[model samples]
Target chain A: MNTFFTIVAGFLLVNIAAGLVRVYLGPTPADRMLSAQLFGTTGVAILLLLSQALSTPALVDAALVLGLLAAVAVVAFVMRVPQSEREADEE
Target chain B: MSFAGLVLDGLLALSLPVLAWRALSARDLYRAVILFITFGVILALAWARLGAPDIALAEAAIGAGITGALLLNTVGGLSRKNDKDDERPDEPTDRVGRPWRTRLAVTVPVTILAGGLAWAVLSFPAPVVDMPSLVGEAVAEGEVSHPVTAVLLDYRSYDTFLEIGVLLLAALCVWSLGLSAVRSTAPEAVSGSPVLAGFVRLLAPAMVVSGVYLLWAGTSQPGGAFQAGAVLGALGVVMVLTGLLVPSLGRGGVVRAGLALGFAVFLLVGVVSMLATGGFLAYPEGFEYGLILAIEFFLTFSIALTLTALFTTVPPREKGGGA
Candidate 1:
């Protein structure tokens, strides 16, 4: 079961690697930024699996903190990017 | 290790460099910043794989989360300067357009310097003192059950003291450089956003609770003051961003007191310890737990204040409104 969890975590890492494609081929900054959000979810999944695999429950707290702060970049992006700049990306 | 675990380790080791290279070489600033955040997440996982949960916790909060926000904020500022371009390039053309000879001149030395540092780290000699065994034995006698926390607060407390002092110093410097036009002093666009207000309202209590939990867990687990402080510090950042707290808060006497509380207390403790125990930073016999906890409690708050204060700028002090 530990091995199974470990392998599953590896696959999720691959998913994160794949998501980086959107970051590279971004049509907009928001599209690029969402890849990080993808990690926030997928990375938490990976951490949970690795905690079970490695028998270290502390990583779950790391996961909790990661999940909690995950939206910070998006919030910052929304706040910092001016309305004109944000709208300009659409048209 | 099993084949599955081995493969997982290999994949993580391989991808870290790939992510770093991609982040560094990317032409688009926004993409690079996003990739940087991605890299931080993987790096935290790598730390976890290496069995360093404390580092993993700090990296998850500071490396991935806080850094991403800061870099994104900076990129926003950078892009706001760059008008009429869909993709803003990060590097000045002068570096890219420099003659290959000049580029080589810079690159060769940097590569050598990096190699030398790597070699020095790799070639580190075993300590004559047998630090781990010594720490393990000493920690058994100490009140702090966790070796890492014991070492941080008891064994090498001088180092921790200086580090906290540095955080306090950074806040001082930033406050001194107040009224910098680079700061956003006007009304916040973020404060008016209902989504953010709702999110922060939900999250702030969790952060506060977790921060205290981390500090409490330091006695027996990988969590400690730094991790707790990072969470609290990030909370302050969110408050400032949402305009729940004004930037001018950093300049206030109360904030300055909060910022210096840990440093001053740590120093006083050391001085009193020196006189009381005949050794600086030496906890009194059988009172180790209480002393460490007291220091950690104050250190946590000051660290949080310092982190938040560094990111803030304030209007210049008027006459009689001095630090």
Candidate 2:
């Protein structure tokens, strides 16, 4: 059980590391921005898994906070960074 | 720990330095900032692995989330201003022109100093005193149920007091160097995005609820004023960037008062308590919990206001940079 959760979390981290390649080669800045979106989802998943594995409910609250604030960077990216190689004004 | 757990911890430990190196060594500023955000996310996980959930929340919110937004905002502004040069991959954001010998000259002594510090830390002995147990007993006597809360508020409140003061001072410094006007307009702002604005409006409630929950949870759990404040401040940044807020608003009396409220309330409480207890920030025998909660409450507001003000640092509107 705990071991299962830990491994899952570790794989998620590895998943993020794998996603780093896309960040480098994603051409447009908007495509690069998806890395942050990946982090928000994967980071919350990791935190939630760790909370269950470690039996510390505090980490759930951390996950909640992470889930809530996850889109902030995306919003900032959309609102601030003007579309350079545009697909749809801010693609 | 099991082998799987060990592997997970190992991945976290190894990746931190690797990610940091990548962020620093990246040629493009945008990539560097993006990598830095990724590093912050992993850093929060590391803190959680160390069983520090409070720091984890703060790091996730402030270090990873809001800081990423702020950095991205700066990157956006820089890219907008310098359209020609930065877009090119060949032009590095910064070029280290120093010769290899000069770099080696600085690197050698710094590496030795870092090694010496690491060695000293590794060799350090366990404490003669059992500080955790002592704190446990003291926390039992205090109003706050949580050990971290007790230490932060009842046991060593002066640090929290001075921290709020420093926050105020930081806001002051940023205000003095007014920088709000130059990059106020955004493509989204000019071409109105009601969808984003509606999304933000929807987010406001969740942020307020979570922030209050963090502050309230601090009495018994890992959530605290700093974490709560950070959530609110991030909300502030979102609103400010959306043009729902005037960039020059931080200079207004209402916002300044909100900024000062935390420090003022804290000092007033401290002075009142000191007059009775003969020590600043000392609470009455049974009134400790209430005092700590009140202080935490105000500190949250002050911190939130200060952080938002720092983010909203445009040149004063009167001399507005023609935005």
Candidate 3:
């Protein structure tokens, strides 16, 4: 079980890197937001896997906080985009 | 691993990466955000499979629930002309010049860090053999029932207190973003397609039932306020996205109560415990279940409201006036 989790953690780290690539190469602010959102979700997965692998309870609290903070940031950023731009897409 | 756990873990392992890939692909930003939210729920399941119920609860609440809502709300706000149309067309766009070096530099450090972390975890000596035994000693020696809850609410109560504070701060920060102008406005009253509306109605009720079950079963089982609050928060998100609930810039009495209730309940519990038992948050021996239930209930309500407010994007109404 421990080996399984270790391997799973490794896979998650790779996914996080893929997210970083998007942040690096994204063409627009929205694209960057999408990439950062990907990191937030994937980071939670990695933290949970690590907590399991190490049999440590503290990691759960850390992971929980990380998820909460990331989501909050994204929501604040998303709400900042202009209504005029939104209207153009709908029209 | 047990058969069910192995399957759950394997599914989480695959889905998370696949979702991450899609989310960053740049072609379907909305779809990617939705997929990322799904990934959070699956990760919660993975945590449950790993035998840490507390973490599982927290993951389901904060991970799948609140995060997904936040992402969806943001996606709704940015429905524009591809967000890419505004970019400078001729800006040295080094598409091919440094791709290989960029790949190497990114991949190498991630590889080493992940590898080293895993190796350390795998090779680290087991700190103790019996978790139950250690917990048992603490409970018996320290005179507390439900060591895990005690760890969260008392032994590590400082962490729990600060966590609630963080939730409050996040909500405050979201409010400070001046989001009233960007609150969703529809051509008509409706916001989603009929099919999507139908699906949400079906799913939202089930989410509520499951969230309540998780909250009630938390004592002597594998769920709690964090998970339940998160699930409820998800329901709020669904309502927002489907236009069932509108974000209004009004600090109604209900909203204030919801935001402050958790910390207040926790504080009252601590003070009462200190008065009755001469120590903070100390439940009398036979009152364990009752006390945990009360605190968890208030915590769930507070967490759910706080998460909704955090994602609501409505500003704090100015003093002596309405928005």
Candidate 4:
């Protein structure tokens, strides 16, 4: 069962890696920021799966911390790099 | 390890370098910062696979969350400065003007140095010493059930004490730089959206509870003061970004005291222990857990404040115009 969970987690991680291509090829900062957000959600899933696979309940706490704080970077991005500024940079 | 575990580890290890290379080579500063956050997450997973949950927690919280927020803020600040200076916002201003020959000259020795270090690490022999056994024997007298916490707060607390001092020193250095004028330009305050406002309101309490729980759990599990501090610091970053807590408020007496509280309490505890027990940082017998928890509580507050202040570089104005 643990092995099965680890395998599923590995597949999710591969999906995350695929998502990075969008960030790399982004035409806008917003696109890249979205990719980072995807990473945050995927990371929480990976941590959760690993916690179960590894039988170390402490990892769940790490997941909780990540989920709670991951959106912060996006908030910073929005506040500091406004939509107009990103659009302006494109020109 | 099972086949699945091995494959998972292999994929994680392989992705780390790829993410790191892309982060470094990305032309867009924002892309680079985002990629760096992804790299940090991968690295945290690697730490977990290596059986260091404490390190994994800290890496995720501080390495990814806090550092990503700081980088995003910095990139924003730089672009804003560029706008004021009438420079191209897309172009990096801090690019070095060294010739390719100079770059090659630096790269050669750096490569050789890195190779030598890698070789040394790969060649290291398994320690013949029974350090774990020694620690195990000694840890019984300590209050904490976790070995890492026992080592950090009881066995080798002087190092921890000095680390808190270092954090305090860093905050002091940033304070000395004086407030930058650019902070006043922070987006129209509170984002003009009710959803974000409600989110911040809801998340703030949850983050506080998580931070406190992580600190308390450190006595027996993989959480600790540093991890808890980073969580709280990230909370502060989120609140500040939402305009809920202005940077200038950090200049107030209460905030300043909070910033100093960790180092002060730790130092006081050490000195008192030295004077009374003839050993620095030696908790009185039967009260080790209580003292360590007390120290950790104050340390968490100070760390959170210091990290928040470090990111918010502007002092609060007397007029209180901004949020």
Candidate 5:
């Protein structure tokens, strides 16, 4: 069952690669943005899986920091964008 | 190597690259961002499975949290003026074809590197000198019982100090990018989403409790101030993002103080110890828990604040460009 989940999670990493392609090929900036986020989320999943499999305590810290940093990045980016641009770019 | 763990791991492994691919392939950036955040959460879970709690915490906090915020900000900025240019390519002919050379360049190297790494990680036996064990023994011998925490804040305090500096440096780099010029309207604020606000309200107290639990529990288990503080900081981030809490330059003295508090207290305690006991970071014998708790609390606050600030961009004031 754990291996199953690991496999599932591992598959998700491929999705991340797809997301990366989207990021590069995305028609709009929003698309690229979405792709980047997808990568971040998937990266987290990988860490979670590794933590359990490896049973090494250090990885937990890495995961926690990753989550925290991801949150901060989103907040800061949202805050920095101009209102007018946000309005215009909502598509 | 249990059947269950193997299957779960396989599933996770399978899903990751797909999500990455879809994230990059998606037409809308918002979808990608959401996907990425979800990916981060999953990664945390994976870390837990691997038995590396510290790395898990860092991955969740830094990899998922901070990276997501930064990407979103960049997207927002680009959407404003560059939308038209960024939208569909300007190919004169039919659909644009992905460059084969680019594909080969990316694929060949990644395949080789990943294969080599996977094989290496799988084949390597556990090293004889396990630092965690040595650290654990040291902690047991010393007043600090938690090896990880001791490694982070005591035995290896220097690393902790430098890591904090790295965090500051990252914040400075982001600040240098001129994010402050953007107005703080907080269009992404939680006020727009009733459900989100409600969720935040519900989660606030629980998060606080968990943060505390993680801190105190670190002495015996896989919890500590850094993990707890990051979690608590996350709560703050959530509130700020949702508009439940507004940030301002005027009265952030408390926040500023919190930002500076941890390292300050640590350094002060270190200096004081040197003056009193003739060594650095040496808790004055019997006052171990007291000093450790004090430093932990301050560090927690500072970490929370610094993390928050790192996400909150400020415009530079009259400094020469590109310093």
Candidate 6:
């Protein structure tokens, strides 16, 4: 059972690494920002799996913190992105 | 170790350096910052894998969440400055005047040093010394149930005391910089956006609950004041960004008191303990847990306020001024 969890976590981590390709080849800042959001969600999943795999329930707390605060960076990005660039993208 | 676990560890080890290289080499500052955040999350995973959930929690909260926000804010400021100077908007500023040889000269020793450190780490003897037994014995007489908290707040509390001092000093330094004038012209969140306002309303309470939960759980679990404080600090950032909480609130008497509450309480407790127990920061025998809890509560409040203040670049508004 623990091995199952570890394997799943490994696959999820690969997915996260794959998402980095978008960050690397981003045509716009928004794409890169989205990749970060993806990372947050994926990271939470990995933490959860590892918690079960390692039989240390305390790791769930780390996952909880990650989930609660993950949207913060996105909020900062949206608020700080230039008005002209935002408008250009929207149009 | 199982084959699957080994593969997972291998992938994590491999991705760390690759992700770091990609982040550092990214041409766009924004992309670089984004990649850096991802790197932080990955690093947090590594910490978890190493069985240090306490560090994992801190890394996730402060390293990824707060640091990412700070970097994004900085990137925004940099891009705006570039616009003022009519520089290219998408690309980061070009390297100025430093020759490739000079850069390589710096990189070679750093890389060798990093490799040497990694080699040392990997070669550490099997069966790492178990400190849990020692910590358990020490904490059994202390107030806190959690081993990390016991070590941090009791056994080696002077370090924690100095840490609070460092945070306060950092806040002082930021305050000394004087407020950025561009703050007045900064873009405000659109007030008409119901979606955003509703989201903030929903999320704010959840963050508060989680922060408090982390603080309370610290006595027995992996959560603690620093992690909880960071979550609350992130909450403050969200509120400020959404314009629900004005930056000037940071300067208010109540907020200022909250900012000083942790250090002041800690010092007062230490002094009182010294007078009563003949040792600084030594909790009275029967009141150990209560004192630790009291100190942690105030510490969380002050740390949250300090972080929020540091993150906000604008100066406080004058009384009676409308947003």
| lDDT scores of the candidates, listed in order | 0.80, 0.81, 0.61, 0.82, 0.62, 0.82
Q: For model 1, how does the per-residue alpha-carbon lDDT over B189-236 read when each residue is reduced to its tens digit?
A: 455657777888898999999899999998998888888888888888
- Tens digits of per-residue lDDT, candidate 2, B16-120, equal 999898888886667777888889889999988889898888889887888888787766555433333345543453474778898899899999999999999
In model 6, how large is the Cα lDDT of residue B294?
91
Instruction: Identify the runs in model 2 with alpha carbons over 4 angstroms from their true place.
Output: A85-91, B80-95, B182-184, B187-191, B314-323
Q: Kindly report which residue stretches of model 4 are placed more than 4 angstroms away from their true locations once superposed.
A: A88-91, B80-101, B123-125, B181-191, B314-323
Greater DockQ among 1 and 4 belongs to 4
List ranges where model 5 is wrong by over 4 Å.
A1-91, B11-35, B86-130, B181-193, B247-254, B314-323
DockQ versus reference, model 5: 0.32
Stronger candidate by DockQ (1 vs 3): 1
Give the TM-score (vs. native) of candidate 1: 0.90
User: For model 5, how big is the iRMS in angstroms?
Assistant: 6.2
How high is the lDDT of residue B227 in model 4?
Answer: 89
lDDT (Cα) of model 2: 0.81
Q: How well is each residue in B1-323 modelled by candidate 3, as lDDT tens digits?
A: 55534554665677668666655653444445555655565565556556665676576566655665566566555444443456532233334356788889988999999999999999998766787777778777552355676577656775786788788777767767777633544422233345555656676677678678767656544466787787777666555544466554245787877888988888888788789888787766676557767888998888878766665564332332221
Which residue pairs clash within candidate 2?
B179-B313, B179-B314, B179-B315, B180-B313, B180-B314, B180-B315, B181-B314, B181-B315
Q: Model 1, which residues run further than 4 Å from truth?
A: A87-91, B79-89, B92-95, B179-192, B247-250, B314-323
lDDT tens digits by residue: candidate 6, B1-323? 89998999899899999888877776667777888899889999999999999999999998889889878765655534334346554553344457889889988999999999999999989867677798998777666889999888988888999899999888878878886522412444546667777778888899999999999999998988899999999998887776666645656678777778899999999999999999999888988889888999999999988888876774433332212
> Which lDDT tens digits does candidate 4 get at residues B255-287?
888888998999899999888899999888888
Q: Name the weakest run of 10 consecutive residues (lDDT summed) in model 4 chain A.
A: A82-91
How far in Å is the alpha carbon of B82 misplaced in model 6? 4.2
Model 5 docking tier (incorrect/acceptable/medium/high): acceptable
Candidate 4 lDDT: 0.82
TM-score of chain A of each: 0.90, 0.88, 0.81, 0.92, 0.71, 0.90
